[model samples]
Target chain A: MHQIKTLSNRIRKNTGVDSIRCYQCGKCSAGCPLAGDMDFTPNTVMRMIQVEEKETDKKLLQSEAIWLCLSCEMCISRCPMEIDIPKVMDFLRQESLKEGLQNKSANHNIIPFHQSFLDMIRFTGRSYEIGLIADYKLRSKKILQDITLAPQMLMHGKLPIFPKAVKNRKNIKEIFKKTNML
Target chain B: MKKKLGFYPGCSLEGTAKEYSESVVSLSEQFDIELKQIPDWNCCGATAAHNLNKTLSLVLPSRILAQAQKNEMKEIVVPCAACYNRLSVTQYELLKNDQLKATVEQAIDMPLNTSIRILNVIQFIQEYILPEIPEKLSHTFDKKVACYYGCLLVRPHNILKFDRPESPQFMDEIMQMLGAETIDWPFKTECCGAGLSVSRTELVGKLSGKIVREALDRKAEAIIVACPMCHANLDMRRPAIDQYLEMKTEIPVLYITQAIGMACGLNERQTGTRRHLVKVIGNYFTKTRIPVENNENNPITVEEII
Candidate 1:
């Protein structure tokens, strides 16, 4: 119970969203684009955190809602209480990753995709479209998903063959190191 | 000194949205606004970083802001809606929290200055380009356009505070100035499932598919967008969108700058209109003529029209 309280407090502080302020309005879930796909609705996640039940907390972390959130801020935009639901979702995602909580749903590649994006950023100081696509495809094994579109993008000069590195990549690496992303 | 704005094109400009970069450059050139690219800027950590690490999300944008300040840039224009949102939110966060600012400053190893103004393309146009529309424009768009704001440009209203989060009209007003009959669409500020264009292509298709369908149903000739990610999702991922919709929708997704650039008598090449996956603007451009002033000294040449 103490450990759960400490975790909830940390998340509350990190996200700056007072979960207790939520009255289960369900506006966040209504406005969410991916709400239908989420295992747990945005409002339910908030409630679970507010309730601070260990089983609910575990379920919230393990649910596919964290990974499925678009973070489009639509839910908060429509929320009457002006709650930052997306921020809470962000906190949940980080927490889930930190604790190595396995996502309930199978075949969701958002985690690997996010990892590839960060990896590309760390390597080149910016996102390399070609590299990110390759890495994500390799990880997700969805090789032929957008294969047809690649030729068109290349023709339109949308996908550059080589990645452009920033002037001081060493500095970017240092920032990553300090942030413990390394 | 000439009026200049610090330009942060973000990673999308370098790849996947080169046309946006081209059109912005040409549009700025015509408007006499010097765009100084920020020196040694890194990624803003985008949607991915913020989900993984909160500190990294703030730090990446702060570093860019710090570099912009070092370059003596008072006002910065971030054309990409995603980049603008990240930078604007970071600025808002830093202004509201001193500890976070100090931590970010420490992370970046630079003195932070939160006074720099970050402007989205719509805001930039409203401030700088709208007033000069009459004199600069040689042709009117005259076609009905659905200006898609997507999600990042207008949401999280308190932090961004640019236009109305629910129904933004800055882009519509700008399109109106270009003589485009802007449609009153419902999905103007809808989410296009931005970063999921690759990870969850079907979801993007479903979300962006609805937006495209809304535009088409309302008889919008083209869907004008300010964000590169929106363009990539809506334009590049058309097959998925088409598959999801179960119909062939060929509406041209144009950057707001590209639309404005063409209205200013710039040719298709100058505005990077030829790079679109679905070619819809060619007919409109071929039909419209650049209204030339009848002056003895400044004769209208055929080359200008072609």
Candidate 2:
């Protein structure tokens, strides 16, 4: 019971967005392009956060809406309350990850994509596209997807054969460690 | 004083959007805009870092800004809108919150300089290209263009402050000056399924399809964009978009830099015209010859029409 009350308070402290501020205008969901694809719409997620019940709070974190959010600012731009829904979405995603509540119902390898992207930056201090894509494909098991486009992209000099690494590898590792990303 | 603008070409510039990098560099050379590449700069972590870890996101961009500060660079021309947004947003956030700034500095292990101005590609052009180069253009970009300003360039209006969030005219104005007919269309600041490009490609097809369909409906010949992600989805994802639309609404998507390069009389290949997945045809190069003949890249003066 006590934990449920802290959810909304933590959201305010972390993202500066108060769940209670939402007036259920449905403006955020109305503007969201990914609203149809999400397990819960933006407005529904806001409502759930406002409810602050144990079940709804857990479901809110478990919902795929947070991951689906583009953080495009379409909602915040249109919101009457001017609540930063994108910021709230980010906070929810981190919370979702902490609880291992990432939903895999949708055919979206979003987590793998994020992991592969971070791995590229963490290793070389710069993104190695070839490495990133290969790693993503392997992790997500979507190897055949976009295979045809690779040769065309390579021929056009769009796909670099080699990754350009940043000179200071030590600094990148240190930064990662200090940020608790290690 | 050395007149060099710091250039931080994000990961995409090195890969999928190599043409963008090429066109920008070529255009800079023609204008003699001494663009100094930030020495040993890292990736800005992008949407991935922000989605997963909060501090990692700020630190990544902070490190890049810190590197720019080492060279005493005042402004960095971030060609990628995503990178520009991240850098600008990080600067805005860190500058406002000292506690967060201290945490970011500790993580980055570098002296943060959030005061350095971060300019997007459009702003970069408005500052450098539009000043003196427009008059000297050997060729006119006499094509109808829908200037696409994806999410990051102008959205989250409070932080980015460059153009109007919804109906931005900066890109259109620049295109109009280049002698291209600019169309007033919806979805100017719309999301183009940016990072979900590879993961959920079908969604990108549907999302980016709307932008293309509207442009084609309005009779826009080509879509001009300033961001690499927009280009990838709009151009590289053409096959998917076409499949989704169930019609071959194929149109060339050119980077703002590439369009400028073509207007400066550089050939289609020089401006990375060949790199496009949906082949860039129709008024591909300069239609009329100009008087300027000295510059190696500039068009030669015509004696007569063959």
Candidate 3:
């Protein structure tokens, strides 16, 4: 059981959230709104990190739990030790992508959603709802999923037809590169 | 005296939540306040960036803050809780960690150093409007309402320090100022599944549906919120929510600004209330959107729409 590159070690390095400090109080899981939708509850995920077993770590990475986190911060708000579980969830999601071990079935659309969001920002430097929806539909192939809502949104002026850009979109593209998102 | 405050409407404010932006702007205008958009501001890199990369989240907000600093804005009003949280959290993260701040500064190619106060919509109202609200009120909003804080505005309590983490009272207090009856409810600070409303509609249905349900059971006439994300989940996703709960819920979700605007004599169209998916009922929400021959020239004013 090497300590350096383990999920706990990496999460600690990135977020400064020590999973070792999580006392398995189950308070986080209890408060989390999305706990029902998750494959692994927050407390169970914390316990797996505490155990630090290779099998559990691998299983956790591929699990849909990481992507399911809403980052609602309910867990940390209730946690006695003030463990930042939401931050840990973010790190785990990033790791899941790096290893290409993200759950293919349950949480497949989550990645596409995030990618489209980043792409929207990278190009326009502002969120373009129409652009985001169109790109997400292309990626997720749920083209007609919310197609009906568009006309209503446009009519109400909820969805702007053109993308809003910062005066300097060139800078935004460079940010994606520097952050290694490109 | 028109006091100037930097404005960062965020993406949702410009798009899906333009009504929120409109209400905020019109409401501020009535108070003789000027909200200038922070020059060439970029996206705050919202829930998506934080979910995948911390640096990107920090960098995106850093650019906005840098521009604010460059413009010499002493304080800026961020109407969106998600944007407020991101800017506040990034500032907290950057102030303490010079190393991370330096990296973000390099990425944005600007100085990260800033002390420009970032104020959420609630704080903005409390600071500027609340003092003079009693004097400016054209009428009181007498509806029974639930003040839904959602998350982000109050959570990460150690850093945000805006209100109580779980049971926040700021929005409630503001609603009280508008002469609205604020209901006592448990889900005031709960998660509304705002981040996933677009991609995970079912989950949002369950989460936001529960909030709306709680408000309904308590006999609230409206669910008042300050964040666009919360409004999107509670208002725009009403169909999914009705589907989830197996019941139609029509209690309108109003941004705090919209409620405040109505108090100051701004009509439903002026506050963009007609744009809401759920037709807001009652005397206050009576205007309907009307088509024009040339919308660009005949910008939809309150009188014209009414």
Candidate 4:
């Protein structure tokens, strides 16, 4: 119970999405592109937060809903109360990561992809496609997923071998340090 | 004097979506709009950062905005829709929340400036390119095009405020100005399952497949977009989309800048049309009724025309 309250307050403070403001309107779920794939619909996630049940809240954090959200902002666009459902999902995802909660639905590699993307940016101050793909493949062990497309991508110069690091990379590293991301 | 705007190409422009960056540069040059790249600009944190860390997401874009401010740029043009969304949303958030602004400034070690306006590719075109369309266009695009806004380009209507979030017409209107017939499609503002192109390939295929099918069903010769993610999914992920649909669809997904560049008499190479994975632009030129006289023997071969 205390955990649920702390989690809800943290989400509200971080995302500025008031769980109480969501009035069971299912417009978010209806407009969500990945609603069908989610373990909890967008509305259900919000309702779970409002209900303040610790187990359900933890389940919501561990469910595929947080990982599956595309952050397309469709839910907020259609929300009558302007509840930013995607931001809520983002907060839940951050919480899940901090708590080391692994999503039970492991079919998707979104978590690894997100981590790889951040790692790329943390290293180079910008995303390098080749490095990102390589890192993600190694982490997820799905190296064979897009092997066939490499030749075509290389031909078109879409996959550059070298990444151009930003000039002020020291400042970027300082940013990560100051934000406690390192 | 040429008008200059601060440009943030984002990481995708340097990587998987080089063609978009190329077209944007070429088209902007044609219009005499100088796009000065922001110096030492880092990643905008995109969809991934926000999901992982809120402070990092807000600080990353704020750093870029601070750089633009330092450059004395009044407006920053973000060609990538995802970058535009991140920058615009950060600006909106900073304006509304002083605590966030302070934290972001402290994190980035720079003074925060939320006044620097951020414009997406379409909005930039509507402002700078649309006015000069009549004088610039040498050949009319006589094919039907479906303008796909994807999601971030127009949604979160309160913050973006560029076009109708439900059914945007800025891209369609620009296409019409180039003499192309813009199709009225239902999925114009639909989500393309962005950032999931690599992680959840099957999901992107299903979502982008429906978008492609709708365009094809409406008899659109091509689908025009401004987002690099949309192009990557619709074009590079065509095989996956085909697998999901159990049918092959060869619709060329073009960046709006590419289409505009072509319509303005720029060669295929100049517009970076040769970089597309699906290869529909060649058929687009050959099938057009305008009869490009330069390549009578092989209108499909852009190199021949060049």
Top candidate when judged by TM-score against the true structure: 2
Write out fnat for all predictions, comma-separated. Answer: 0.78, 0.80, 0.81, 0.83
Model 2: DockQ vs. true structure: 0.84
Least well predicted 10-residue stretch by lDDT in candidate 4 chain B:
B297-306
CA deviation > 4 Å runs, candidate 2: A1-5, A106-108, B284-289, B295-306
Looking at model 3, give its docking quality level.
Answer: medium
Model 2 clash tally, residue pairs = 0
A110-159, model 3: which lDDT tens digit per residue?
88898899999988898888789889889988878877777888888898
* Candidate 1 Cα misplacement greater than 4 A, ranges: A1-7, A104-108, B285-306
Candidate 1 C-alpha lDDT tens digits along B1-306? 457889999999999999899999988988889999999888899999998898999999999999999999999999999999999999999999999889889888889989999999988988988887777776667788999998999888888887888888888888887778999978988899898888888899999999999999999999999999999899988988999999999899989998888777666676777787877534443224444442123221212221
TM per candidate? 0.94, 0.95, 0.94, 0.94
Candidate 4 stretches greater than 4 Å from native: A1-6, A106-108, B281-306
Residues B1-306 of candidate 3: C-alpha lDDT, one tens digit per residue: 799999998989989999999999988887889999998999999999998887898999999999999898889999999999999999999999989888998998988666889999999999998998766665567778999998989989999998899889988988887678899999998999977887889999999999999999999998999899999888889899999999988788888888888766677766888889887766542222322221223222222232
Q: Ranking by DockQ, best first?
A: 2, 4, 1, 3
Q: Candidate 1, residues A112-161: lDDT per residue as tens digits?
A: 88889999989999999999989988988878878788888898778899
lDDT of 2 at A22: 93
**Chain B TM-score for candidate 3:** 0.92
Error of 4 at B30 (Å): 1.0
